[model samples]
Target chain A: MIGRLNHVAIAVPDLQAAAAQYQTTLGATVGPPQDEPDHGVTVVFIELPNTKIELLYPLGDDSPIRGFLDKNPSGGIHHMCFEVDDIIAARDHMKTQGARVLGTGEPKIGAHGKPVLFLHPKDFNGCLIELEQI
Target chain B: MIGRLNHVAIAVPDLQAAAAQYQTTLGATVGPPQDEPDHGVTVVFIELPNTKIELLYPLGDDSPIRGFLDKNPSGGIHHMCFEVDDIIAARDHMKTQGARVLGTGEPKIGAHGKPVLFLHPKDFNGCLIELEQI
Candidate 1:
């Protein structure tokens, strides 16, 4: 059901500093920071040859990233995303298998403008799994 | 400097159950578990179309993963590995940029039999980063 590894998301306290480290130190090509209101985070994509690295920061006080940052003051890996061919079918498959989907259990438009669903960390052995339809 | 995302490692309490979840529920092709005494972890790789997911469990009492699991009883994403064309160059660059390389700053043979070095999480926004020569 899962296709390619889409991107790995990292929650950061300072998005600019984190993006700058990747750009300057790692010599990586980073995209512009984008606000994802639905996901309640501002994200920047660091382009890689095979996959991308997403740097995320809280969009608001109530943002989930803010909560994550609160627990991990230094920031941390938030989630890992995998590509799926058919999001609806993937969601149904996950649901039938008893995996809890975050939010409304429906697909949401993600940073790549693709339909995405987040699987509960508990179900995936403490790692939040994001499935994106490519 | 990084070539591709090699894999994302998740520290799990039960390696067999975690591997089974990916194999049966997610319908992924999971490889057999292998012991890495040097790294002090037993790992299983779940092959995906684009990148692989590595499930890790403590190999001994002094295993780093054991400490991680103690903090997170359920399991969680431990580290993300990126491929580098020249590991020595990558290591030098990371060192020049003031990034702390873990374990005596030497490259060790990783699970894929590749030269690998780990960067401290504090330097990379709290996400443990591993660079492996492809």
Candidate 2:
């Protein structure tokens, strides 16, 4: 079962501008961008009191967010992540409930170096959900 | 300045189905729908450990989310709400930084009964942002 709301990922058209807006305009503490070639994203974290806002930009040619950016142009919320205690159990439960696990149906090491699984958007109120083990 | 991420709002095509998905599938504690006629929205809250997830559905003929639902029939993230200690000060600061506040540039009573203001998506990486007084 989902525990805490981990983070909300927003795919942005301009990474530096988004970071600057959060820092200067919103007065939030933002972290430096870290490129995750495996995830195909260059991410910056805007730290909040209770949670984090992740600014994601496409990395390379095959970056997953490139398609999202092409469609949105101005960018938008890409996905929401929830923390689970046991990922395997959570994945199995989701499967039993007829929710499709994205990718190879296996948990992958996520952005935080934690085991994570993505559930199909269609099964989750059209919201892409990432289940991260915490 | 922004303090806490109050909630993430998701506009859904089917209110009951979305609430059921969060309650049964995600194992989250979902509250009953509360219709805000003035705001043209019916909302349900899913309580998370860190923050809340707000599921928004069109209330009547002039629902604000109706336009969003028309574009993405399957539904999607509508906006992100962050809490601030002083809403007027926050609004003034955002104005000084060239961020346009939606509507009359005044804080309206949000669904939570707190003073809140909406910022134009164009200034926020194309994401709608709501700032509420904590």
Candidate 3:
């Protein structure tokens, strides 16, 4: 079950530019950018009062976000991550409810520095949902 | 400038079922549902710490979300609502940056009971962004 909105992930073509734009326009400072080699991407987090905004850009063309951008160039809303107390329990519950997990098994450290797993969009009517343990 | 995440909008085929499912699974109560004639849809809000989850369902077949669902039925994430301190200023800033406004004038009250306006996905690369004032 979703505990809270951990962060709203946005896919952008340029992470540094996006971060700077948000900072100048919204007056929101960003956290340090972090790279996740496994996901082949880098992320910068804009900390807000309640929820954080995550800006993502692919490291290369072969990256998933890059492909997503190619398909939907004006990268729309990417995925919504919900904080959960237990990733395993949440995955199992979603599975019982007929949701498909993206990876083989268990969540690994995600770009946001949390144990995260994705639910296939097919199960939730085309929305990719991320479950993270905070 | 963006305030904070007011809520994460999710498009679902069945609003009632989705609300019930969320309430039962997440142990979160539902706020009274509301409908916006302008948007041609009804919404149910599930409150959580810091952020709320909005379940949206079309009132009729000729709805924007409906068209979105037609293209991608798995009903992935919808729009992200960011509370802004001043809607007019924010809109102008986005416009100066070449973002297109979906609606003709200023923001009207949205389904979530706030002044909300949409920025066309074209500017942001394919993301329908909502700006709301709390």
Fnat, 2 decimals, each candidate: 0.81, 0.77, 0.58
> Which regions of candidate 2 fall more than 4 Å away from where they truly are?
none
CAPRI tier of model 1: high
Assess the local accuracy of residue A48 in candidate 2 as a C-alpha lDDT between 0 and 100.
93
Every model: Cα RMSD to truth: 1.4, 0.9, 2.3
TM-score of chain A of 1: 0.93
Candidates, DockQ: 0.81, 0.82, 0.57
Sorting all predicted structures by TM-score, with the top scorer first, yields 2, 1, 3
Q: How close is candidate 1 to the true structure, as a TM-score?
A: 0.95
Candidate 3 wrongly placed segments (more than 4 Å)? A60-62, B24-28, B31-33
* Superior by lDDT: candidate 1 or candidate 3: 1
User: Model 2 chain A — which ten-residue stretch has the worst lDDT?
Assistant: A118-127
Cα lDDT tens digits for candidate 2, A14-79? 999999999999999999999999999999999998999999999999999999899889998999
For each candidate in turn, the TM-score is 0.95, 0.98, 0.88
lDDT of 1 by residue, A24-100 (tens): 77878899999988778999999888889999999976787787888999999999898888999988987898899
lDDT of each: 0.89, 0.93, 0.78
